[model samples]
Target: MSEITPDLVRHLGVLARIQLSDEEVERLTGQLDAIVDNIAKVSEVATPEVAATSHPIPLSNVFRSDVPGDMLSLDEVLQNAPDAADGRFRVTAILGEEQ
Candidate 1:
């Protein structure tokens, strides 16, 4: 079993830029020790034959086929625009720049 010392916890807190109280450090030591122990157990069970995976079940891309379709004309698209110029939609300059 791996042991988590108070000094190690204090170092981790300093590296993470967190101010941890003495009580918090003591409490976190036990929690981190338990976590490390559990990870060690998992490592014991994991073998070279067992492939590492991110998920328990298999996954595949679920995407539709990319087929070209008829597109709207410029006139049909610009009909609803509040402002249009040069066959395109025009809006007020947000950055106070001339169009």
Candidate 2:
């Protein structure tokens, strides 16, 4: 099994953009080592001969056929808007900076 050391933990923290203290890195190293061991065991069981299955139960596409439906007019659609301008709904500015 691969040993996860402080260096490995620190590298992982950098990759994840996480700020960890020296003590946290030591704790995470042990935790990650155990997780890697569990994953290695899983890989051992997954052989070339065995078929990969994502879900335990059988699944089929339950979507209905695409059919054109009646659409409300622009005026009708904009009728319920808290704020509307011309023929469309007016929304509050999201960008903090005002132009």
Candidate 3:
């Protein structure tokens, strides 16, 4: 198990430019020790054959078959638009100049 000591905690606090009190350093040393020990335990159980995953359960993409369907005509599609150009939607200039 990784050893987390008061000296290490103080050194980390200095490296991080954090002013940790003596009491805080003592408390964090124990907490960090426990954390490292637990991580070590988990490492022992994780074997080469065991696939590492971010989530506990398996996941897959649920997608529908790509098939074209009937679509509304240009006029019908733009009927509800707030503003439209010759045959497309028109809005305020976003980039100061049109592309």
Candidate 4:
């Protein structure tokens, strides 16, 4: 079991630039010890035969093929716009300021 003392917690708090109270230090010491113990248990079960992965299940790309075909012309695209100027969509000036 990992031994996390109050002194160790206090020193860690200083290093992290955190101001921990006596009660907080005492509480964190036990919590930190438990976390370290759990990690140690996991390490014990991990073997060279087992592979490390970010996810439990295998993943594959689910995207369609990138094929470019049939694009609309500038006139066809601007035909549906409410307002257009200089071959571009015209929008109201934001921030209540004059353009």
Candidate 5:
């Protein structure tokens, strides 16, 4: 098993652009090491004969019928909007332009 050292944790933190203290790195390294060991144990028991199952129950295409029905008009759809402009709902610009 690959050892998760403080240096490895520090490198990961740098890649993710996160600031972490030495104490945090030590704590995280121990936790990550245990988790990796646990996953290794689980992988050892997995066999090719058994089909991989994501959930406890078998799931298939659970879908609803796509039947067209009477729909609301454009005006009716936008009627409940607090601020509507043209034919759609108006929202504030996320990026402010420089004056």
Candidate 6:
């Protein structure tokens, strides 16, 4: 009941521009057949009534609640900075880009 044949494997090798050895082609044919059989088994287990989903269980957000709190003054923020320019933090130019 193997769906993949050595001839099909050889054809695929040619299409992919690969020079597979005779043993490799035989091995790939068997492996591909097993993969196809497994897929068929999986499809059989899946029912139309069962909705497709990304996860097995329901997921909830693991982040803190977004509650707006405090606003820091520009001078307060610039006080601890190594350098400040035009009311903003000054950083070194990177990747040949102008600062």
Question: Mind giving the per-residue lDDT tens digits that candidate 2 earns over 13-54?
Answer: 999999999999988989999999999889999999988999
TM-score of each: 0.80, 0.58, 0.74, 0.84, 0.59, 0.76
Deviation (Å) of 1 in candidate 5: 6.6
Q: Which stretches of candidate 5 lie over 4 Å from their true place?
A: 61-99
Compose the digit string of candidate 6's lDDT tens values, residues 1-99.
678999999999999999999999999999999999999998998999889999999999999989999989999999999999999999987756553
**Candidate 1, 4-96: lDDT as tens digits:** 899999999999999999999999999999999999889998999989999999999999899989999999999999999999899877875
Query: Could you tally the backbone clashes for each prediction?
Result: 0, 0, 0, 0, 0, 0
Score candidate 2 by TM-score against the native.
0.58
Quantify how close model 6 is to the true structure by its C-alpha RMSD in Å.
2.8
Per-model lDDT: 0.93, 0.91, 0.93, 0.92, 0.91, 0.93
Q: After TM-score superposition, what is the CA distance of residue 82 in candidate 2 from its true location, in Å?
A: 16
**Which candidate achieves the best TM-score against the true structure?**
4
Model 4 error, position 23 (Å): 0.7
Candidate 2: C-alpha lDDT: 0.91
Task: Rank all candidate structures by their TM-score, best first, as comma-separated numbers.
Answer: 4, 1, 6, 3, 5, 2
**Lowest lDDT block of 10, candidate 2:** 90-99
Model 6 lDDT, residue 1, Cα = 65
Q: Write the per-residue lDDT of candidate 3 for residues 7-39, one digit (tens) a residue.
A: 999999999999999999999999999999999
The Cα error of candidate 6 at residue 47, in Å, is 2.0
User: By TM-score, is 2 or 6 better?
Assistant: 6
Candidate 3: give the clashing pairs.
none
Query: How many angstroms is residue 51 displaced in model 1 relative to the true structure, after the best TM-score fit?
Result: 1.7
Q: In model 4, what are the clashing residue pairs, if there are any? A: none
Which pairs clash inside model 2?
none
CA lDDT for candidate 6 = 0.93
lDDT of 5 by residue, 1-99 (tens): 568888999999999999999899989999989998999888998889878889999888879889999999999999999999999899988886873
